[model samples]
Target: MQALRIAATGMDAQQKRVETVSNNIANMSTTAYDTRRAEFADLHYQQLRAPGAISSSTGLIAPAGIELGLGVRTSAISVNHTQGSLRQTGGDLDLAIEGRGWFEVTLPSGDPAYTRDGAFKKTGEGLIVNSEGYPLAGDITIPQDARSITINANGEVYAYFDGETEGQQVGALQTTIFVNEKGLEAMGGNMFRETQASGAPIPGEPGLDGRGAIRQGFLEESSVDVVAQIADLIEAQRGYELNSKVISAADQMLGSTTQLR
Candidate 1:
């Protein structure tokens, strides 16, 4: 019975791992999508030795009994933080983070958020925003008739209007860092919300205080490694299969025991 329970637990853990891998594959093309990896831990062990059944007195039988395991359970799911490669899109609004830092922005509801994806665009009001139309945190806005938009490595935006003497600074971007970014809770759309476990957000100007420089005309791709995810998927599948086989073997053993005279 204990073996059966343990095998069931193994199946459950593998099922969860398989689900995680499936999600990774499904989001392989999603920009800035982070892959999740699951972990498991063994349950508590039980002693089956009978009370007052020791051999010190009778010297007949030993108090030996197998220690049964309760089962296993999911321990954690760590988010990988490796930076993705920058893809040159040649779009003026397209941006990529060159190092460790997240572009701080507010959600459509004005709630503060952070994201590694930098595929930003301009709204009808000429305000710099992301694809989801969320305004950039710095309240940076540009003129409607601006021409020749340029974003420098230091997160500064320059634009020259049709009749302007020269390009002017129109956008000033900032990034934020956390003590533990992996602990930040994902809120979809490649955005993350601050959590107690993540610590406080440290806002800094781009290219300063360890924040990453903004690369204009480019976008960051997803950091997932296809080969690694595939390998993990294969291993999880095999583990599930082996657990199922163990359960089948245990059922057969039970049948044989029932047939004993």
Candidate 2:
């Protein structure tokens, strides 16, 4: 019966692992997406005999204790924050970070959200916003009469008007960094929310104070690797099958015991 229970836990753990792999594979083409990994921990152990207890026959202390692990449980699912390769999109609003940092956006509820996806668009009011219509922080706006726009690596925005040899400065963009980016909570849509574990957001201009430089006309790809995910899926499938076989073997043994007259 204990074997049956222990094997069940294994199956559950493998199921979680497979789900994680599935998610990663599904998001392979998602912009600025990060891969996730499932972590597991052993359950409580059943100690049949104490290690330091005196032997009944020889009156000597036991060297090793008998400890049987109950099962495995999912400890956490950690996100991999590795940088993804950048692709040139040739779009004016498309941006990507060369190193580290996040773009701050204001959610509909007036809460600030962070994201690595730079596929931004301009609203009818000339306010720069992401695909979800969330306006980028600092309220950078473009004028209607601007002929062309230019964004430099330093996060400076400039617009060129008609019959002018020089470009006028519109508004500047800022970047946000975190002490522990892995501690941020993923809110889907390539957005993340600040958490206590992630510490407070560090705001500064792009390419300054260790923040990444902004690359115009580019987008960051997802970090997921399809081949690796397929391999992990196969391994999880094998583990699940093995645990299921253990449950079947335990059931047969229990059936044989009950058949004894």
Candidate 3:
């Protein structure tokens, strides 16, 4: 009976791993996408000892110890916050981070969220916004007639107007850091929110206090590795099959005890 439960646990763990790998593949092209992975730990084992309650003539030594692991279970599916690669797109609004920091964005709920995606654009009102129309944090706006826009590694927004020899600073973009970025929970749409486990936010300018520097005309690429994921998938499949065999063997042994002749 307990053996069946043990095998069931192994099945569940392997199934979770499969789901994790699938998600990683789905977001392989997503900007700033961090990979998700499942963790497992073995369950407690049972030991059998003693053939009789009282044995005066025989030694009091208990029967040889036998470890019977119940099963394996998933411990956690943590988000990997490793940095992604930066790609040049030749777009003024496109931005990418060079270190550990997140660009703050306004959410639909009027709350602030963080993102690594820097595909930004200017609205009709000259408001700098992301693809979702969410305004960038710190309020950066450029003139409609601005000839060309440029940003510096220090997050200084510059605008070049017609007949202007040089660019002028229009706005400043700031970055936010966390003590435990992996603790942040992703709410989809390339957004992430703070959590207690993530600790408090530490705001700073680009290239200051270990904050990430800004890269104009670039985007961050997903950090998922396809080869590693496929290998992990195969490992989980084999593990699940082995557990199934254990369950079947236990069943056959139990069936042999019955005699219908």
Measured by TM-score, the strongest candidate is: 2
Model 1 TM-score on a 0 to 1 scale: 0.90
- Give the per-residue lDDT digits (tens) of candidate 2, residues 87-169: 99988889999899999999999999999999999988899999999999998999988888889999999999999989999
The lDDT per prediction is 0.86, 0.95, 0.89
Any runs in candidate 1 off by more than 4 Å, and if so which? 48-67, 163-165
Candidates in order, TM-scores: namely 0.90, 0.97, 0.89
lDDT tens digits by residue: candidate 3, 73-166:
7888999888888889999999999999999998878888999899999889899888889999987999999989999999999899999989
Candidate 1: which pairs clash? Answer: none
Q: Which scores higher on TM-score, 1 or 3?
A: 1
Give the range where candidate 2 is weakest over 10 consecutive residues by summed lDDT: 49-58
Write the number of the candidate with greater lDDT, choosing between 1 and 2. 2
What order do you get sorting by lDDT, best first? 2, 3, 1
Question: Following a full C-alpha superposition, what root-mean-square deviation does model 3 have from the true structure?
Answer: 3.3
